[model samples]
Every structure is written in structure tokens, then in C-alpha cells.
Target: MALGTNTGGGGVGAGTEVPALSGAPLLGSLHDLKSDSLGTYLRAQQRHGDVVRVSAGPPGMRADLYCVFSPEGVQQVLASEAANFRKDNAFYQEVRESFGNGLLTSQDEDYLRQRRLVQPLFTRRRVDGYAGAVAAETASVVTAWEEALDGVVDVSDEMTHLALRAVARILFGTDVEATAEVVARCFPVITEYVLRRGYSPANIPRSWPTPGNRRAAAAMDELYGVCDRIIGQRRRAGADASGEDLLTLLAAARSPDDGGFDAAELRDQVLIFLLAGHETTATSLCFALHLLARHPEQQDRAREEITRVLGGRPAQARDLERLPYLSQVVKEAMRLYPAAPVIGRKAVAATRIGGHAVPAGADVILAPWVTHRRPEHWPDPDRFDPERFTPEAEAGRPRYAWFPFGGGPRACIGQHFSMLESVVALAMILRAYSFEAVDTEIPVGAGITLRTEGPARCRIRRLDGPVGPR
Candidate 1:
């Protein structure tokens, strides 16, 4: 399989099609893709090699997909020659129904403009400042857990709440406990509807009065209504509004080309930030804690590092560098279960990948969940080992091999923020509590992000002092 150079942004029909992974007649692989997306991708890659054409969607009429699982293929689709690939695919088009033209769903010029506008919000200094908020939120959750010591807790749910609160504090500059509660209730509805549309080959239009669509519409209304209330209240407060939050910044920012983000655009970006921001980070943290619980030795190693570094003090932004093992644990957990498991892009121009012809309008899937676990890139791919992410070990691997936050120019803008938040949260939690895995079998599911099928249950024990020995 030879790599193809980008041949300008021009559309061309697929020259030589790759072999197809056989699935049910007419349905093709849609059911498999929707049912067990992770298993389907891994199985396809194992059977058909790295790049296989997936015959999904309607019987014909250009519903073919090229699933790319190799690191080289991932780099091509996500980074190099990314301009030829667009987010204007079926999945993203449906996502835009709820997300609007936010960074997650927007493409091309609009995407570039949005990226430029929002990038500054996540600069190193800005993300560094968020560490304090992340630590504080984690500490708050820890305090709550202290009351419930010896009780079983849903780690996933708690992480979700913690993430929402942290993002609320960082992005809104005020506590949105009430708003977060509303989102926590309604966002799942939006996720359920959007996930169905994203994975299903034949999706009912949102305009149709289907029961699912009706529920989705109501959920969007409620979710957006919450945003409206927050923004509305801020507007009413005017000068009293916190001048440093992302919402305030967006309200003030104006673009010469598009005249800046209007009310609708503001709502879209804020909703995306609130929804995407909390969920992915929460998912990653949940998996990290679950992994640590499963491996007590590794957990002890991390806790020991945190105890020695802080010497009984809570984790803060300045203490990150001193906590290398904790960082490795976070990276390894993300490798096993990347938050954004699959990245989808549609080809706007004709291209060749792995010596096979890829035509315009083909949906390209770059799945880290599959690629990260590839034996070539990772040894004992299923094992939970943080040593793989050590500085010495990471230098030998490809940049895209373990991208939990993604890669390339269009990689997650909140990558730094997520990492800082996760590490700080993990360190703080380890300082106060040690989790024991209550459910040995944790089921994986696919939604907006890779998610747990049910609440990841863990037994919590509050630590009296240092995690090591006494």
C-alpha cells in the first residue's frame, strides 16, 4: 500500500476501489457499524487490512466508506492534506442540527474562522489558569465523597458532574450548577438522537415528526433554552458580567468578514463547548479511574508520586510537572479508550490512500480506538500499562499513535485544557480517596464519544493520609 500525495483540491471518481468487508445484503455493514462500532472497526482491520471500503448506507448511490486504521492513513486524513477532507459529511451534517455551526460541526472557511476566534481561549496561559478551577472542582467532589465513604459510587456520573462544573466555572466565569443540572438531564436526549443519526446509514430527517425526532427537538429546545437563560442573564447584568470568561469574550469579539458571532452563533458555540467540553473529559477521567482501580499497583505508584510531590497539599497548576507518573496513567487510559473514538471526514477532492483510489464524497473514518491498540504501535495493546507513555517510550512511536485529544491542525482546541483538568482532577481525587473496582466487567458503548454502557460503579475509601504505606 503506497501513500498518495495530495493532488490539489480536485474531485475525481474512485480509480481503483479497495476490497469490501462483506455484511448483510442491502444493509451492508450499517448494523455492525451502529451496533458495535469499536468491534466492527477492529474486526474489519484485522480481516481486510488497514484500509477497507465499507459498503454501508443505501444499496447504492455513493454510500461507500473507507475506514482508515493505520497511523499513516490517520495522519493523511487528519493532518497532511486535510483541506481535501471536510466535515460536510452525513454524520457532521446531522450533528450540526444540535451543534449549529460550532467548531465541532463547522467546516472549511467557517471552521477556520471559528478556530481562529476560539483558539485564544485555550492558549497555554489561559489553560494554565484553568488548572486552579479544575483542582477546586475535583476537591469539591472529593469533599462530597468523604461523606459517602465506604459507599459504592458511580464514577462515570461523578466525573461527568465534576467536568460540567469545571467547564462551567472556566467558560462562564460564574457557577452554573443550575444550568449544568438542566444540561445533564437534556443533553443525553440530544446525544441519543444524534448518535443514532450519525451511525445509521438510513436516517430519518429531523423535520419528520418521528417520535425520536420529536424528543430530539424538545431536548434541543430545552438545552438551548438553558443557554439562552445564561446568556440572557449575562446580557441583563451587562457590565456586571465577568469580563474574562469565554462567553464574555465571544460577546465582545467581532470579525471583519462575518461581523462576529451573533446570538445564534454564540448559542451554538456555547452549547458545543458545554456539551463537548464536559462529556469527553468526563469520559476520559472515568476510564482513567476505572483503569487505576483495576490495577492497584499502578494506582499506588501514582498516589505515591502525588503524595511525595504535594506532601499532603492539594494538586495545583504548578505541581503538574512534578507528577509524571499520573500524567502517564492519564495518557495510557486515553490510549485504551480515546474519548473521541472515531473521527469522520468526507473527501471533497479525489485522493489515493494506501495505494487504493478514494473518490470524492467518501466518508473516511480515523479511529484511534483501533489504531492505538494495533500491536505494531503498542505492545500488549489490551493491558493497562502507563510505562508505554514514559518520555523514553513515547519518543519511539508516531505522533498519531496515541492521540486521545486527536492531532493535526484541526485537532481538539481544548486538548491542553482537557489534559490539565484530567491530571489535576485525578491527583486531587487520589489525594483524598482510593477507588476499588466494584464491577469487574465494564461495558463499552458508542455515542457522541466512546461511553460506558451504564454507570461505572466503584467502591470509594477515603484516604486518611499518604497513599503509600501509612
Candidate 2:
């Protein structure tokens, strides 16, 4: 089925009700839903067509939410009528403590203003320039893995470390490792706390001195301390006008209308960047490597391509276009396991998605996790097939069918930066090492991002000699 039955623009007609997916009258689907929410949503979508209404929260206070699994329904909410959707949903409420009014949590004019300010920092040329830095950081990670090749290495941990280093290099030019350690230490705590609260029926007010709340507060404080110290140092040294690192550019940036970011605003933006910048790409790379490890034929094919294209040199920005198979592998991995598995938006005004009425303040979830696996859109939905992303194949699919980075204007600002980072990092690492999956089946769970339940272990064996012509 493609989305809803009706294609008309106006909201679902009066008396026409989109059937609700069966659940406990009071508890609804709450019992069935677990940390592996992606699996729950996928099963629900298979049973109940495109749009399924489900209940959440505790008994009397249960909240009704809609999950849109159809590409057309997703497109309507994310692109066509996006103005009716706001970012201040339950999820954002949980995250606001950490994100503040930064781009990720802010809505309306504040969001637009911040977007304008940060826009210049991620231009095509600017992101391309970071390829050299990304390549260098990725090489450092591969070299470090040389000693641990004899034991099972946690690709998840390694990717997280590598991604943190890459983003830190891009954000803070000099003290990269030290800055990344601070981010690595605090981000997991803050993100986990926020996600735990987002799903809880009874909420603990942040002001309360509960132990969990206190721990979350301390993490936030440490995060702020680190951001403050670095930004303070940059300000004291005078902003580097020509510098390409995010800190320098943000510190130097002065909007013609609203002026520059104040201390608090700087902290908020940096927190969002630090948390979001590394985490999504890390999750993507982890999944990509895991998938490649499981499919040795595909891994060998990728290695062959890398050898042909790169000779023995580390992957650079110019080499990206030539490595089509590597790009497909990454894209397909994201299709199977999108980092941001579930995206939530609240309706600001009564509207419709797929002709189903959505009341104001109601939360609508668009899950790439569900849509990407919908059997109607993807044949053999569970199969690991990178060929699905080939140019000709992609040309036949719906536009919103594979939006791992999301869609429309509110989509991830760092999409280009992320793609470049993944492609470069994967190429550099794959060329130098061959990974064997230690566990064929790894459990999936949802925290702030899609994650593995335990460490995704892989055995690595280094390729003899250099990978390409340097």
C-alpha cells in the first residue's frame, strides 16, 4: 500500500477514520514496545497498513500518537506541510535540558536565525576542505587498531572514538584529543538520561534532587564547563577570521540582524554540535563495518574497488566520486539501520498526513526504520543489498523512501559533512584492514540513536603494505 487511501489536499474528510492498530484499550502498545522500538514499529507497520495510531504513556494519561510508514505520508509531514509541524514535541521536551534553544531543539524564528549563522560553516567547499582532516584522523584510528588485531575489537567503540576525534578536529583545531575526551565522557550520560525520560510514564522534574536527575545535571554541568572553557579561550585569543574550524567561525560570526552568539548561546550551539556531530556518523560507520564484516564477498569487492581506485594512498575528497561501491555500502547500511531511527514532530495546527486527521499538539512519528523496511517499497526488505542504492535503482524509488538524514529544510545541516566523513573513513580503514564478524547476530536497541545492545565485536587483520599510492 502507498500511504493513505485519499490523495486530496484537505485533511481526512469528516466521519472518515483511519483505523487504529489494535492494542490494550488503556495500556495500548506500551507493553509490546521495548528498547528495540524499530522492531516493534516494523512489525506494526506490516500488520497495519501505512498509518497506524498507537497509545503510549501510563493508563489514564495515555497519549495517542501516529506512526507514518508510507513514503507519501512522510513526505507530506516533512516537506509539503512542514509549517504545521513544530519541533517542541515530547522528545524535544526531554532533550531541551541538554540542547537548550540550539538548532536541534529550537523552533520558529530562533531556529532560522541560528541556521543562518551556522550555514556558512558547512558550505560545500568548507565541508570538502575537511576531508584532509577526516582522512588523517581515520588513519590514526587504523594505526591504533594494529596492536589490537589479535583480539576481538569493538567496532562500535572504535567508530565512536574515531568519529569523536574527527569532529573534534573539525570543531577545535588544536587540543583535539583532550576536547574529544570531555565530549566522549559526558555525551552518553546526558543522551541516555534524556532518552530514559522521554519514554517514562512518570516524569521526574529536573529541579528535583533525585539521584538520576542529579547525575544528569552533573553531566550537563561538565559539558557546559568544557564548552565554556574552550570558547572562552578562543575569545581571549581573538576569533580567527580565516579559520575553518566550527569554534573559530562561530566565535567570529556576527549576524547582520541579531549580532553574534552570546556566551550561553555559544554553549548551547556547541553542545548540540558536539553531541549530534559525532554520534550519528559513529552509528552509521559502526553499522557499515558490521554489515561488511558479515558479508565477506561484499567486503572483498569493496577492497578490490579501493585498491583499483586508490592504489595505495589514503582516501581524499577527490577520491569520493570514484568509490561508488563504498558509497552504496554505507547508504545500504543506513537503510537497514538509520542512526536517527525515529523522528518526531508535533502538529502546530490541525492537519492531515495521508488524509488522516492529526489534531494540534499531537505527535506524529516518521520512522525511517519502518519505512525503509516496508515490503511494499523494498523487496526482500531484510536483505543486505547495496545494489538497491545504485543510480538506476534509486531513480525508480519514491523520493522520501530513503531519507536517512531526513527531508526538507529542517533536515540535518551536516548531511554533506557526514557523508564525506563516512565515505572517507570507511575507504581508508577498509583498504588497510579486513574485518571478520565475531558475532553474526547483534542486538539492536534505541537510545538517543539506534544502537547495538552490546558491543559489536569484529576481528581485524591488517592488509600487508600500503593500501594506495600516497
TM-score of each: 0.92, 0.94
Candidate 2, 169: how far from true, in Å?
1.3
For lDDT, the strongest prediction is 2
State the local distance difference test value for candidate 1.
Answer: 0.80
Model 2 pairs whose backbones collide: 311-468, 312-467, 312-468, 312-469, 313-468, 313-469
- Give the Å shift of residue 131 in candidate 2: 1.2
lDDT of 1 at 217: 90
Strongest candidate by TM-score = 2
